[model samples]
Target chain A: MARRSEHTREQLRDLMLEAAEQLIVDKGLAGLSARAIARQIGYTPGTIYLVFANLDELILHVNARTLDRLRVPMQAAVAATDDPEQQLLGAARAYADFARSHPNLWRACFEHRLPEDVAGPDFIDARIAQLVELIMAPLARVSGAEGAALDAAAQSLWSGVHGVCILTLTGKLHMVGGQATEHLTDDLVTHYLAGLVMRAAPADAR
Target chain B: MARRSEHTREQLRDLMLEAAEQLIVDKGLAGLSARAIARQIGYTPGTIYLVFANLDELILHVNARTLDRLRVPMQAAVAATDDPEQQLLGAARAYADFARSHPNLWRACFEHRLPEDVAGPDFIDARIAQLVELIMAPLARVSGAEGAALDAAAQSLWSGVHGVCILTLTGKLHMVGGQATEHLTDDLVTHYLAGLVMRAAPADAR
Candidate 1:
């Protein structure tokens, strides 16, 4: 943990991000600060400011990394099956597993908000779009949905699955009636998809 | 404001909650504290503590009130229609409307986590159970779902609707693709219910 004598700017940035991610993992977002990250990495607070535009920028970068990590399991789940229902279910399960295993990190990704003056970064949006497509593809196959309807379908189903994980992690799920999280998730995906298929082709339904 | 000598403990507790709620409305949960609440209500921090065990307890009380306030619209929405679909939709709309109007209070209800040593109060659970019943009743009517399946259905759909509101308020929904929050919610409820009906009487489907 020596000072930055040998590190390039990119290397220093990576080091700072690694140290910050560890701090967030250990303490959660409330306790995270530029000074804390700097201290953990043996650098001055000023050095962190030099690498990132601000604290919000640093947090966004951290969230972006978390999103990238999240994509691995989702991709594998999608690739593991040709059946769209199983694919979607696999993705949902992977999502829940990721959140459970890295509760602090996953929470930080959503809980950290950019300030009013700063626009949301495009990279975060891009990452989210990628994740949503994992659902949208299977959703399209299941429902024959396309255009705005398909988009709406994907977002809603994704939100439902996301909600199940979030409520479960926060202990809100148990407040109503403690069903198993995985069961609720399966119930959500299975039922929502069934509903989607029924609604998809009016002629077929009739 | 006069000092607390004129008021009984219960009355004083009411005053403190009113003041704390106003503070939360203006400043969100980050700035809430006993000192701030006491200062607003013309009492010392010790006086505030006398009425509540700790800050976490006070927050739980505030969230309970929010839950109560939320039930008004949900109840009205359920009563307005006999159709199960409309009933569920009305309740979902009421929920989204409440979140949009009282974003801070609604967020605080979910966002506030009790300390590790302090167990969540029974009253909060009671309030949530009442709220979930609004969805469960219509859900039961819609799908002929009963018992554990009924319970899981109600909880998952509720979570999906809640997820829409949270992500919409937090700007995370737009990151995936900026579909209308209401639309996503409607899609979730409609499709999930359809799926539920299909699954509930598998014998009928064949």
Candidate 2:
């Protein structure tokens, strides 16, 4: 039997998703499309449309998978240590490592923008929330921040770490001073945490 | 008698650049191309090729102009305040404001990537360096850091701020939390500065 006749809808979906991911990994978003994915998986472009509502939907699925893969290392980094400071640093490092290792896939998670009329699937937002929460747990412990305060602190700190990774990968880091990406990430996490601790301190203590 | 006959090569380059920028402003990078620009300016695509080597070269020129425009407000921010903390915050807010107001142009500065075979012109790097130096001067005053240490401090802090702006614009900030972008930016700068101050403190005082 030919390979096309061997699978059901779910299996075909998986195969298509895998191919789309591989294409993005190899060539970034520019190389991704129903036709390209169909060619890779031995299916017609029409078949891909049957599996995915549109290219935006397919891209979201790929982004969701990338986020899920990213969560693993970050979760492990948090789990590997109990000290809040170390946990934060470890998580930051893990994020930088993932961005470095999977540069293209990682870029797609942020770089791909949907059309104005399209609504992104909610699960993508949920996955992002989960990762932010993982970082928040350690940050809350370190800063003693709660509710919205904790939310802002965690988000800001992560944004800083994320920024370091992005500029590093884009070759913009050297345009400033050529600091190592890891060191910049480390500095951001440490300094931000120290700042949080200071703010949380009683005025008399300072 | 055609509109194309009304300009010298330099004037045509300016007209094409303006059209390209407007297209980007209205529809982002997706809408930009030599053909589109040529059409908007009443010239043929061949005319664009005559003035610029390729689209990437034109984009670099556009980005360089954006950087130059961005420098004006940042320099004014730094010069506006004598306090290092306020200077840093002011410059950051200026960046955020510019990104918000001219989102397409600002995004184009970072989002447009040159082909792998092309070498980015040196002037782009120089433009970026000027902005980094603007941030670094305030940081050095605040942190008492100098040499490579100062360079690292400035780069890390600015990277963090840049990260916040990117995430906020991309809607990732809301995914993490609902804090306003400006407030989150305020938090990152204030906290990071506090951390730097704490670290700079004498051991006993700290």
Candidate 3:
């Protein structure tokens, strides 16, 4: 079926991303190629050029798409929660689950190196700030953690979750055994969260 | 310079890892090859076969050596700290520093998918657990943080630091101008530590 001119751009963009995603799934990021994407998406190589200036632009678009998809569930996970700790956990779980299910796209989101000529948009950072916003205010409200301590806690929590996501995504967690991974992650999160709360509780110090 | 068999094996292993490291530095991991390593190390292709079964083993040996090197600095970082939060931060900083300096090996450590025939040794878990011991016990003692909360906090901190490390290593943070990468990392670490403490604090009688 021929794509009409009005929606051809949108259709082609989606097609290109879908094609690239498939290629990555099968061959990893290095396997992606404009010619292969063109062939797979049923577009002539010239048509891809019409839609994307080059492969970098196409990759940037797909990378943005991956971040957008990740942000949605992360926001939803936090927004649906009222307890600060619970909210953090919800977001963490959502992040881990999404990363696991969409390993290729997720990998592209984090691991893809931007070429010298290209710059990604600021939308991804804004999305992260939104997720961070969900947790930060509640943290600042705590009496004892009004400053630097609060900041450290947030950074710590964020890194710990990212480690799990990365380890699971790259299949590194498998080396430790699945059950051990689960247990260790659980222990780590529990301990870190306690540290966070303790730092903010002056009268009830650790 | 012909040498004893013992010296030959030691020199070969060192040569292999040094060559692989240079290759990664030159062309990145995707361009890595056993043949390239053999050539760079001044060994015939067949000579590489004696030190390792194949390219994958060679890469793994290099990665393990890198990790072992990292463990020393990381342990020292934690050893220099007595406070719980400081201990955690010191370890995280050490980890981040290693990632920044050895982006290729750092990347290899997390990208741990195993081919069917490649079985890993089992001691890495115990080594990691040693690191965990440094961060876990002190962190878990915080107020308002019980079992699960503590665990989540630890996990989140690990992930957040790893995220920053990877982003910095891969130049994902290059777009953020004005501040040096070290400054940005410092800011990230500081805020994370604060946030963790804030989150863990229990609200009670003022």
Candidate 4:
């Protein structure tokens, strides 16, 4: 009997999350509320508290799901190419594509502000590290920089790519004219990788 | 008599914007409303509409002020150094510094989404163009890639640096450990510039 009840509880949680995700997709983070989630799932508002500590926790869970979705394409992009440069480009393209396709979901991942004193859960940090690891493989190959240098390179490069994604999505990049997001992504990766290679080149090579 | 009335109107406009800015600083974009602005300024909500077209217009004006404030440091950073590379670096550092110091205002510049059917005002686009121009001069000196190539380089590099600023400000960078935003900006500019120089290098130089 206990096992059956546990399974039901798990099912209820998933249902609420799905409803919350749908709400966010339609209305954005500002539109998400515990009462709204409960209404969508046909449960009482108090039921939401029973499942999650607070709305912030539910948002974090939603963001985690978004990150998980993002990870799949990124991993595939890396696997699709053996060339380090191509891998970097593919990953960047995948990231941009994901953001373009799911603007609200993608934005929610970054735009949701945590309370000032609260640190994000450890699992979310772990997920971010996992995403960074995807880039580090190619970055390590391109820069030949190891340990701390390799980590810094990965962070910097990803941040650059992410910036392009944000601006492009928000229409800020429209001022650049005629440059598609893909072209911009390609340009960023090509030039940035070329730069890393140059720095790693022997001094006498210049 | 008309001039005196016009002066009063201008003063009222400035007062409302100041109130809006303060509200955003304390509570973010969601906290900003025509009602809040009027409350802060000791005026009826109707007075805000009298000065601006609507809430969106008022927000745009506030963002314009933020951009104007941002321009000061960016211009100063460029003038502080003659080296093209240092100028780029300085500008990037200044950008990150500005975002850090005026996070709410800085974020409002990007966070406010215009309605899909509406185009951003020409003046806002001009302001963005001006910011890009600051990068172009130093980039033109560094890459020697003229015309479209120069434009592409400038946009890509700035986007990359902007990404670093976004992640750093939002606390995502903390997951990567103790790397300072300044170091990340330096690393991005140095490596990306090196890449551009290499791409521009003659085949025989290789």
Candidate 5:
């Protein structure tokens, strides 16, 4: 009987997250509320509190789910490519593709801010680290930059790709001639990686 | 008497924009509305519509003012430095600074979406072009990448900087030991510029 009850609770949590994600997809972040989630799930608001601490907690859980969805394509992209440059490029393209396909969920990952007094959960940090590690491998291979340098390079490069994605997603890039997101992503990764490789090259080769 | 009324009409327009900007600063974009702007400026909602076509137009004008504010610092940054690399770096720093200082207004520049049916005004396009042109001279000096290449480079680099600013501004970067925005900005500009210069360098020197 206890096992069945535990199983039900887990199922309820999943249902709430799904309902919340769907709400965001349909009406954006503003549309999400405990009352709304309960209505979507056909449950009382008290049932939500029993499963999750609050709306902020629910948001984090949803963002974690988004990160998980993001990880699959990114890992697949990395696995599909053997060359370091292609691996990095593929991962970036995958990231942008994920953002485009799941605009609201992907955005919520970045857009949602926890309150000042509240600290982000450790699991979310682990998720972000996992995403960063995906790029670190190819970056380390290309630049031979290790320790802090490698970290900075990975963050900087990823930020650039992310910037391209944000601008492209938001239509900000349209004003500049509507360059395709893939082209911009490729341009950023290609040029940035080329620069890294050349910087690491020997002076005689230069 | 006609000229005096025209002057008052222009003054009212300026007053309305100022009020709207202040409201956004105080309460964010969500708090902004035609009625709110009218209230802020001691006028009726109908008065705001009379001066600007609608709330969206007022937002656009406010964004234009933000862009104009951004341009001043960027151009000043360019003028402050003589070295091509320094000029580019300075301009990037300036851009980031502008975003940081006017978080609401800077965010509004990207966050405000015009209705799909309405075409963005030509003046907004011109404002964006002006910002892009700030980087062209230094980029040309560094890479000799002209015309299409230069334009691509400028857009790519700025996008990278913009990404860093967004991440830092939004607290997303804090998850990674809280790296300073300036550090990320410098790292991106340095590495990207270095790569551009190296690519342009003669093979023997490379």
Candidate 6:
């Protein structure tokens, strides 16, 4: 009895996504191709097409997992803390942690753009947006920074976390010495969030 | 007789370096291969070799120019300010400006790993080290911060600035609106420095 689909559908789906992710880690998105993925999984390109719309869609699919890695940790961190400020900072710390833990996947999430059919103007899905929203939601409630400024600060927070994450990914930061990554990330999160909260004493910092 | 070596040694050197820089700006470092560069200026790759040795040598040659790009502005910023704190801020701003102004070149300077022949342990280069030393020299004078803790604080500052520069480069900050990049970078710089300065004053923050 030859098993054409020996793996269950869910298992096959994970295998496909995992293969695509490892491909990106081994070779950047530029090097990804349906044939390459098929070779990795012992499937024909047709099988890959059955699983993914194309490489861009495939990457988007894997990036969702990367974002999930970030979101789950952040949610747990937020849950761990009762204070809003600490929760926000904790979310930031979790972000840096995920980034360090999964540097390649993290890069694919931020740097990878998906095909139009798959992502549209927003993203591969609402997952990253949802995570960003979770981070900003508390700040928005407390600061009253609506629409653009709130959005800007939210985006700024993304960069703040991301900035430290990528630098720490590189061996370059090793020269700076001892938990510099953690300390610097903590500083950015605390100060940037504090600035957001400083709406109480609003000045021309705008 | 076509005018033999029509360009002077220095003239030809400048022209090739200029072409290399333009290629970096228009395309990334990946696009700045020797063949691509030779075709751009209608010079044979041999001519480029005459100016420099191998690709690694060529990159070092380029950084000779790249460091100039980084160094001059910092020098000018330092000249313009006398207030220690403001001077510090301006220098940080200048470092950011250098990155923004020459994206490809900065990418070249930081992203490339120097070959082992050049990057020996305890190896420090004058160009970048000079700039970092200048930025941290003020903190060295502030008597409040002593020995190892001060070293840690200054290292954090460098990491923060480097972190911000990288995040901005990848276009990750694009989604956030309202002067986000500049504002957030400034915020990170100010706050990280503030935290460093506050290390002496802060009995309660602990």
Ranking of all candidate structures by their lDDT, best first: 2, 1, 4, 5, 6, 3
Looking at candidate 6 chain A, the ten consecutive residues that score lowest on lDDT are A113-122
Per-residue lDDT tens digits of candidate 2, residues B1-206? 16977999899989988888899899888789888898899988888888999898898888999999999999999999899999999998888888878878988988888776765679998998899999887888898778877787888888898898888877776642224667888999999999988787778877
Positional deviation of residue A23's Cα in model 5 after best superposition, in angstroms = 2.0
Better-scoring candidate (lDDT), 1 or 3: 1
Instruction: Flag regions of model 6 displaced more than 4 Å.
Output: A1-16, A27-35, A42-57, A111-121, A124-128, A137-158, A174-178, A190-206, B1-17, B41-57, B60-64, B113-126, B139-146, B174-178, B202-206
Model 3 over residues A79-119: C-alpha lDDT tens digits? 88677666666766776777677777777767777654655
lDDT by candidate, in order shown: 0.85, 0.86, 0.63, 0.85, 0.82, 0.66
B98-206 in candidate 1: lDDT tens per residue? 9888988998898888764666789998898899888888889888899988888888998899888888777877633234777888899999998898788767563
Model 6, range A1-206, lDDT digits (tens) per residue?
14346877677668788888888777655557888877777777787667666666777778877777778989998889677778878888888887776766777776554332432435544775777787777667656677876776666566666666665555544443226667767766665555455542356533
Candidate achieving the largest TM-score: 2
Better of 3 and 6 by lDDT: 6
| lDDT of model 5 at position B86 | 93
- Residue B122 in candidate 4 has what lDDT? 83
lDDT of 5 by residue, B1-206 (tens): 12223437889899888999999887678679888887666677888777898898998999999999999989998999799899999999999888888888898888777765677788787898898888999999988888767777888888899988888787666433334678888888888888777777778865
Give model 6's DockQ, 2 decimals: 0.24
> Judged by lDDT against the true structure, how good is candidate 3?
0.63
Q: Model 3's DockQ?
A: 0.27
CA shift of B38, model 4, Å = 1.6
Candidate 4 residue lDDT tens string, B1-206: 12223437889899888989999999999898888887777777888888899999999999999999899999999999899999999999999889888889999999898877898898788898899899999998988878878877888888898898888888887533224688888889898898888788787865
RMSD of 3: 5.5
Candidate 2 similarity to native, TM-score: 0.96
Of the two candidates 2 and 4, the one with more favorable TM-score, higher being better, is 2
How far off is residue B187 in model 2, in Å? 0.6
Expressed as tens digits, the lDDT of each residue in A89-124 for candidate 2 is 998999999998998999899888887666557899
lDDT of 3 by residue, B1-206 (tens): 24324347868888888889777756667768877876676667787788888777777776777778777887787679677666666777788778777777777766644563555645554454455555566566533455655555554455556766765565444333323334444544444555455655555532
Worst 10 residues of 4 chain B by lDDT: B1-10
